[model samples]
Target: MKNVLVTGFDPFGGESVNPALEAVKCLAHLKTETYAVEVREMPTVFGKALDCLYAAIEQVKPDLVICVGQAGGRPQMTVERVAINVNDARIPDNEGNQPIDTPVVPGGPVGYWSTLPIKAIVQELNRQGVPAAVSHTAGTFVCNHVFYGLMHYIAESKAAIRGGFIHIPYLPEQAARQPGQPSMALETIVKGLKIAIDVAVELEEDIVTMGGQIS
Candidate 1:
């Protein structure tokens, strides 16, 4: 049985339920006879989120890592293609810290391409009738911060961890508050993530082939 580490953030932005964490928890139930899944939650702050995520990676030492976050304005599940080295948050994080034009890692490269098979994931999601796309930007918020940190850690560490980030749309409740926001049901998000995890584990061979072409 292979182990997979799944992570999501706790509620931020004055919301009661975060679709990121909710979807991760829902997908974590796929622990079956052939695979083991572990789900962890990280803080949504700047300096602390990356450290917590790396600690979880070290502790779990899973075969793959998928970090999920909320992108409220997006209309669908977005497979983020790059994590940039910037922290220009539009709103204060959970710790009440908002950074403007800050580097995610001082002296790190400007960006990191996602190690996950994003196009394949998008195809898989679309096959399931879930709207999905390749998102070029994870935003300059904490999501990008954590995503950049994960990629940087993978580049520098001895751990052979494959890492990527996914941005989910606003939950129905969240979208209801903002009249113009696009909303997706929690169940659909869960199903999409399950397919993503299944692909993350079951499609390693395809990942190598497609990843080479992508690079």
Candidate 2:
């Protein structure tokens, strides 16, 4: 059975709960005849986020890693297309560390494409009634930080591990605080993630398709 490490961020930005972790926790104990899932909660801090991710990677040694984060205004599950080496945090992270125009890994490559079958994962999620698409930018925040760090680790270690990041919308309770913000049910997000993982494990090559933002 393949071991999969699914990670999610803790509550940040003065929020009490993070839907990403909530969904991930729901799948923590999943073990099938073909796959075994292990879930981890990552800190929302900038530098420390990667620290936790690295520790988790060391412990789990998963064949696949899918990092999940909260995107408050997003309406669907977004599979990131790439992780840039830049880190430009507009707001301070949980530990009040904010860096602008900095490199995620100094002297690292400009960016790294996701090793996961992202397009195929999105297609499967969408086919299951979960809104999903390829997201070009993970923003220059902790989400991007972790994404870039994971890809860097994979490249530097020369390990054949497939990894990518996925962003989920805010929970309904979170949206109640800010009127007009779109939110998705936690159950739906979990279902979408499960489908995403299933597709990622089953597909070796991504389906040819046009995906990403315009302009």
All candidates: TM-score: 0.92, 0.98
Runs off by more than 4 Å, candidate 1 = 205-215
Candidate whose lDDT is highest: 2
The models' CA-based lDDT, in order, is 0.87, 0.92
lDDT of 2 by residue, 1-215 (tens): 89999999999989999999999999987988779999999999888988999899899889999999999999999999999999898888898998999999999999999988999998888889999889999999999999999999999999778999999999999999999999999999999999988988988789998786668
User: So what's the TM-score on candidate 1?
Assistant: 0.92
Error of 1 at 165 (Å): 0.5
**For candidate 2, which ten residues in a row score worst on lDDT?**
205-214
